[model samples]
Target chain A: DQQVKQNSPSLSVQEGRISILNCDYTNSMFDYFLWYKKYPAEGPTFLISISSIKDKNEDGRFTVFLNKSAKHLSLHIVPSQPGDSAVYFCAASEANAGNMLTFGGGTRLMVKP
Target chain B: AAGVIQSPRHLIKEKRETATLKCYPIPRHDTVYWYQQGPGQDPQFLISFYEKMQSDKGSIPDRFSAQQFSDYHSELNMSSLELGDSALYFCASSFGLQKGSSEKLFFGSGTQLSVL
Candidate 1:
């Protein structure tokens, strides 16, 4: 059973425009959420993360918003750049889960320059 | 800055053959994790170790075994490999075992194992 799900398979955006990727989760035990960006042949790179206590966390141009009531989370990249094109995987882990993350299927984002 | 290290970036083996993959965690990091990503699929957790002990388990197959050495290095041994076992195996490391901001992982490039 998939506890975390990324509904969108792919997304396209123009350079300098905003890109939003959505994700949903069914496991209430998850207390921490993270977003990772991966290239074609490389491993997933850590982008940003948010704790269950907070609704939003921002780092540079990347922002993650969480809605615990809805079991949903979103990652927003402002003024998307060409380097932002990649597959984004949303992951979650609970306090007693021993820091192991459960990942979503991932969303491929393409930024057109 | 040093990151997680995975050896044998690529490997090829025939069915029923065995393969061993290695990983070296970052300095001072006590936790290690293993994940597998198939073609066009997201990463799936396999197993994890903390301080040379198996701390968590995931979807790892029964034919596979893993261990973390005292030096903080890890090895994954796959026996009687099948065609479906071909995938990118990634190793990640973290500083802390419990919650509170040390759980973030830094991953290696990964080992792409192809079974013929």
Candidate 2:
């Protein structure tokens, strides 16, 4: 069963525009959520993360918003750049767990310059 | 700085053959993890090792096994490989066993295995 799901398979946006990727989860035990960006032939790199206690976390141009009641979260990139084009994955882990992250099917983001 | 490094970037094997993939965690990191990514799907966790001990095992079959050396390097071994085993395998590492902050995993490029 897919506990974490990213419904959008792909997204396209113009450079300098805002880009939003959404994710949903069914498990309530997951207390931490993170976003990762991966390029072709490369490993995924950590982008940002949020704890269950907080609703939003921002780092530079990337922001993650979480809604516990709805069991949803989103990653937003402002003024998207061409370099932002990559596959974005949403992952979650439960508190006290051994940091094993369950990931969602990635969303491919393409930024057109 | 060098992140997680996985060897044998690509591999090809026939059914029933054996393949071993290697990974070296970042210096000073102690935990290592293995994940398999299939086409059009998210990465699925395979197993995890910490301090040379197997801490968790995911929904993988017995044909798959892993070991961590004293130097924190890890090896994933697959015996009697099947066509369904063909996928990209990633090795990740974290500083500690903590859940949120100290446990951000850094992944290697991955090993692409094609079983014919």
Candidate 3:
């Protein structure tokens, strides 16, 4: 079963506009969530992460918001750039669970310049 | 500046053949994890090792086996491969075993295996 799910298969937005990607999880035991960006033929790179204790975390132009009650989280990229076009994956791991991350199906975001 | 390294970027094998995939974790990193991503699917955890010891297990098939060596590198051996075993296998590493801050994984480019 897929514990984490990214409902949107793909998204498109204009450059310099805001882009929002959403993810949902059914495993309450997961306490840490992270977002990764991957390019074609390359490994995924870590973008940002948030703890279950915090509702939001921001770094540079990327922000992650978490809603524990809704079992949902989102990543927002402000003034999206063309370089931001890639597949975004939402991953989660339970505290003390050997740090194995369970990942979502991923959402491909395309930024048109 | 070093990142995880996985050898044999691409491999083509026939059914019932055996293949071995290798991974070199980042310098000073003691934990290694393996994941498999099938077509149009999420990355699924397979197994993990810390300090040369098996720490966790996932949906790994019995036909497959893995081990970590003294240098902190890892290898996955697949025997009697099937066509369905074709997928992208990724190797990731972290500094700490279960540290909160080390939750962010540094992943390798992945090894694509095609079974004919």
Candidate 4:
């Protein structure tokens, strides 16, 4: 059972445009969500995260919005750049669950310059 | 400082053979995690070690085991490997397993294992 799901397998957008990736979760116990970006032959790097207490969090050009009632979350990258092309994974964990995370299948983002 | 480092960037083994992968977490980090990633799929959790003890284990088979030493280094061992075990293995670390905190993870380049 995949508690976290990223429905879109891939996405393409023009450079300098806003790129949105969506994720949904079924576990209500998950209180923290995170996004990671990975390039070919490399490990995933941390991008941004959001807490259940807050609805939105922004860091530089990346913004994460959460909707508790709908059990949904999204990551928005503004002014997408070619370097931003990679696989984005959404993960979640409960506070006392020993920080074990359940991850989505991941969405491949391609930015065309 | 260096991030997580995994040794043996690539390895090949035959069925029923044993393979070992090593990982050194970031200096001073207490949490180490192992994950397996297959082609066109996301990474799946295998196990985690904190402070030299097994913290959690995923639904992986018994053939897969992990150990952590005092210096915060970890090792993954696979006995009687099967073709299904062929994939990319990753190691990660965090300061602590706290929720709602930075909880940022530093990952290694990964070890590509091919079981023949």
DockQ, computed on Cα atoms, for candidate 4 = 0.65
DockQ head-to-head 3 vs 4, winner: 3
Ranking of all candidate structures by their TM-score, best first: 2, 3, 1, 4
DockQ of each: 0.68, 0.74, 0.73, 0.65
Candidate ranking (DockQ, best to worst): 2, 3, 1, 4
Best model per DockQ: 2
lDDT of 1 by residue, B4-106 (tens): 9999999999999999999999999988999998887778999999999999999999999999999999999999999999999999998878775534688
Candidate 2 docks at the CAPRI level of medium
Model 2 misplaced stretches (Cα beyond 4 Å): none
lDDT of 2 at B85: 92
* Clashing residue pairs found in predicted model 4: none
* Model 1 ranges with Cα > 4 A deviation: none
Error of 2 at A39 (Å): 0.3
lDDT of 2 by residue, A14-103 (tens): 999999999999999999999999999998889999999999999999999999999999999998999999999999987677788899
lDDT of 1 by residue, A44-103 (tens): 888999999999999999999999999999999998999999999999987788778899
Candidate 4 lDDT at A36 equals 90
lDDT of 2 by residue, B4-79 (tens): 9998999999999999999999999999999999877899999999999998889778988899999999999999
TM-score for each of the candidates: 0.96, 0.98, 0.98, 0.96
In terms of lDDT, model 3 sits at 0.94
TM-score of chain B of 4: 0.95
**CA lDDT for candidate 2:** 0.93
| lDDT, candidates in the order shown | 0.93, 0.93, 0.94, 0.91
Number of the top-ranking candidate, with lDDT as the measure: 3
